[model samples]
Target: MDKPKAVTAAAHKLARLICSMLTQGEAYTDQGQVCCEERYRQCVLNKLNKRAQQLGMTLVPAAPAAQAG
Candidate 1:
């Protein structure tokens, strides 16, 4: 089966995000850094929501995966 366009677009976005992290990712301790972290997190959530809508799906946080002993 062919991949859905929405998923392909999301994959492209995620790939770009990964590249950006490689160049800009770092731990920082400051108010501005904390705000930036929240901003980026929300931006990703927005993208996911958009994609989910496009695919006629709902988006929700998943429960933590169970770990095998």
Candidate 2:
């Protein structure tokens, strides 16, 4: 969707979350940037893996880089 619709949809989601938290008497805790970034990375990887499996292929993790001599 376009920017306006996307913003509205996000606002609705945030409102619902806030409402649920209030009803449960819970506090809102921000999962810092690192946590959010890691979650997003995992989500992308999961989607990529699923697509690869559908194509009869597998994803292999890259080897750690070697230090310069």
Clashes of each: 0, 0
Q: What does candidate 2's lDDT look like per residue over 1-69, in tens digits?
A: 999999999999999989989899999888899999999999999999999999999999999999999
In model 1, which range of ten residues has the least summed lDDT?
25-34
| lDDT per residue as tens, model 1, 1-69 | 367988999899878877777789854335788889999999999999999999999898999999999
Collision count of model 2: 0
Instruction: Report the error of model 2 at residue 62, Å.
Output: 1.3
Local distance difference test scores for all models: 0.86, 0.97
Structure candidate 1, residue pairs in collision: none
Shift of residue 9 alpha carbon in model 2, Å? 1.2
Under the 3 Å rule for N, CA and C atoms, how many clashes does model 1 have?
Answer: 0
The window of 10 residues in a row where model 2 has the poorest summed lDDT is 22-31
Per-model root-mean-square deviation over C-alphas: 11.8, 1.6
CA shift at 26, candidate 1, in angstroms? 29
